[model samples]
Target: MGPLQIKNILQTSPENQSVTVKGWVRTKRESKNAIFIALNDGSTIHNIQAVAEPGQFSAELLSTVTTGSCLKITGQLVESQGSGQAVEVKIDDILVYGTADPESFPLQPKKHSLEFLREIAHLRPRTNTFSAILRIRHALAFAVHQYFNDGGFFYLHTPVITASDAEGAGEMFRVTTLDLNKLPRTEEGAINFKEDFFGREANLTVSGQLEGELGAMALSKIYTFGPTFRAENSNTTRHLAEFWMIEPEMAFFELEDNMNLAEDFVKKVITYALIHCKDDLNFLQNRLAEEDKNKPQNERSIPLLEKLSFVVDNPFERLTYTEAIEILLKSKPHKEKKFQYPVGWGIDLSSEHERYLVEKHFKKPVILTNYPKEIKSFYMKLDEDGKTVRAMDVLFPGIGEIIGGSQREEDYDKLLGRVKEVGIDPENLWWYLETRKFGTAPHSGFGLGFERLVLFVTGMSNIRDVIPFPRYPKSAEF
Candidate 1:
């Protein structure tokens, strides 16, 4: 009786039963006897073919059925005579809801570069690549919640505005309502924050981990999935000014338990995409293959589907940061001077080094633990060795660090000392310090960059392509 989605129509048996379909026209092919239209409603990547006889509609009406036109059609579902698809619709009547002028429409039935699509992000979702990617992203996100919920983790909503910088990187976007042109000066001629909204310096949160810890301390297990901001000016393909992060904090968990949870979580989300988003994944796999054909044989990657399967089927290799450093120091890349960044005991691992470990050396997902305390965040629990902290980073083949977390320092004195050692004011974090002072338990958690996961799963080269509206340095255009 009512309009049915194109995806549902494509899946049903062709019984010549009349049905109503509403969607945007993807393409139109004109033949001597009829016009064949490909309609897609964004419910699925596949399109439904609708056949219209020459006498069924006027030339004026058919002329408007170009790409991007929205239409509602009443038709009888019948077996298609085509090779690729199984069913199609024989149109009885058509109504043109809206028409897109071919002369001005940017998305034609042709191949467009990813760079060009980035410029018109608002309309890129209609394209097959982006549509498929968005579907997979949705499936992965759903799986994240399902996995955590099944594991008895409560979803925690953390504040977007706060005075504390959890990462201590100082790359924060200041949130202020004070008039810059007005005078609010102190005796020392410093800008007085007493006139500000929060009555103190506030910033867009760089992470929700600190707040998540507060919830985990009471709830035992909690996770936060929310937008995070960073003021870093880097405009690399892997960087974003604003992005989503998945952070899960668990109480009474050690470094080893943390590592296990991270590995299982990643694998579960990937497996979900494989099962639920098979059609979209197949399209993306073919898309990546076609793109790879342009690259040199040595630079080209394996099939996208195979890469995903490898992650789902295989066990991630686990090792200590010390062992990983040893392996890298003695690696062929290091010995032959191929590494751009020097690798050693205290040096932080670069993207190149991380990729080498996962793609070439280990040839699997790697969980590297026990990082040097100086290179890691101050909140990370320091090991008995007094040198390394209980930090862990999960590295994938193409994407370096997909997840980073640590067992939080629970001892009040140790945490306070480390906070001061890192040049962060302990008094500013009095509330956080009180958590340790009152009833602190050993807790562990990790933050996974959601866009990076989508990028990796979709086989997309640029991080900008995965998110719908990308925010970056000097670029926030809708």
Candidate 2:
């Protein structure tokens, strides 16, 4: 057998059975005549023990091996008496597969800051913290697919290189296939972008909502999970140049139906990760205990179980955007910090406002709905109130807005007028108008930032750490 997963070993109750396992050394402890190596494969967060007899393998030889060195050990399964683990192996054979020179390798048996770890992103997965993060990330991704698949949602793949800027924010990273040095120019000094591929300026998609709306008109229910790009140049913990987004669009659904779906979707994902990723979360717990001796005994290192059960079983706190603003402004907690941007009746909610509402005021995930027309997207339906558009933003405790959704404009005239009101040309959205013209239904959808969800699930502090290869402002370091 290849490298055996640590979880599978507990199932292997056959004591004294000889087995070969291959993994990297996490920690190695040596006595006068014996050595114990904690080995871990990518399979599980739990580390396995390999007890080496110094009579067979010298203590000097074992001590020479550094942390993160890959090795294969042939040993007999034995019950461990050590404080750290349950089952251990008495190693009869030890073979070094890959050697780690301790002098140059930055990773050692010590805690490194998150900043230092970012510099060594290539090898950070071998660390316990990152290993758990990656495992949670993988589990959450699987949960997202499973939730959609089990719910009878059609998985739709949309085009990446889109001719239209769906958000109309002009935040697209332009896609070009021409030599700029020998470029076509208009009568003016500016280059003619119309001569580019697709006969017009095309760029990467920022959101799959527009295309998803088209699919929903036909498919009735459709979901798209794909990579999106934003060239906003925002340097923040939550911002990324490129990130994943999951958009679910449903036809014949109102704003209430959309809010229900968003709530269920979030709950389902958290539940799935809790069930599937318990071991990884436990590993993180132990790491936390080791890192902070003063960690609360009652405070759960992994709140996945308790947190998710509450989510699935309970109802999300739903409040109108106006209600949330009132809570933020009236709260006794807001007395200390004066908000930089004036909190008014129509301005967009800042991250501070969002966090305060969800974390302090509600103490649960809050769905802030019916935002002002000036702050929301053009495609969102104008509410009966006239002042507000049908927009909903789901705010979690740690992250402000994980999801943004709205009921789309089914009326062609209204949509065209809204686009024009938003200072965008309706003529440019030629094919998009066809959906409203043909067969239109009351459709609703939401866009959840995939990296943000991953960060929330993995308990990762920075967006860069959640993604394998992060792209941010002025940086795409491999």
Best by TM-score: 1
- Residue lDDT tens for model 2, 1-478: 5566777885577479998878898888878877878888877877888987667766556755668889888889988877866678889888888878888888999889988988888999888788888888888888888898888889999989887788888988988977778999889877788788777788999988888888888889899999999999898888899999999999999999999999989988888888788878766655555655666665423354444454566677998988877877786656555666557678888887887776667667889999999889899999887789889899876678889999998889889898888888777887888899998779999999988988877666689888877888878878
lDDT tens per residue, model 1, 1-478: 5567788889999999998889889999988887899999899999999998877788889999899999998989999988778999999989999999999999999999999999999999999999998988899899999999999999999999999999999999998999888959999999899889998899999899999999999999999999999999997999998999999999999999999999899888999898899899899888878888999999888788899888888789999999999999899999999999998899999999999999999889899999999999999999999999999999998889999999999999999999999999998999999999898899999999999999999999899999999999878999
Q: Which pairs clash inside model 1?
A: none
For each candidate, what TM-score against the reference?
A: 0.98, 0.92
Least lDDT summed over 10 consecutive residues: which range in candidate 1?
Answer: 1-10
**lDDT, residue 147, model 1:** 97
Best by lDDT: 1
Distance (Å) between predicted and true CA of 109, model 2? 0.9
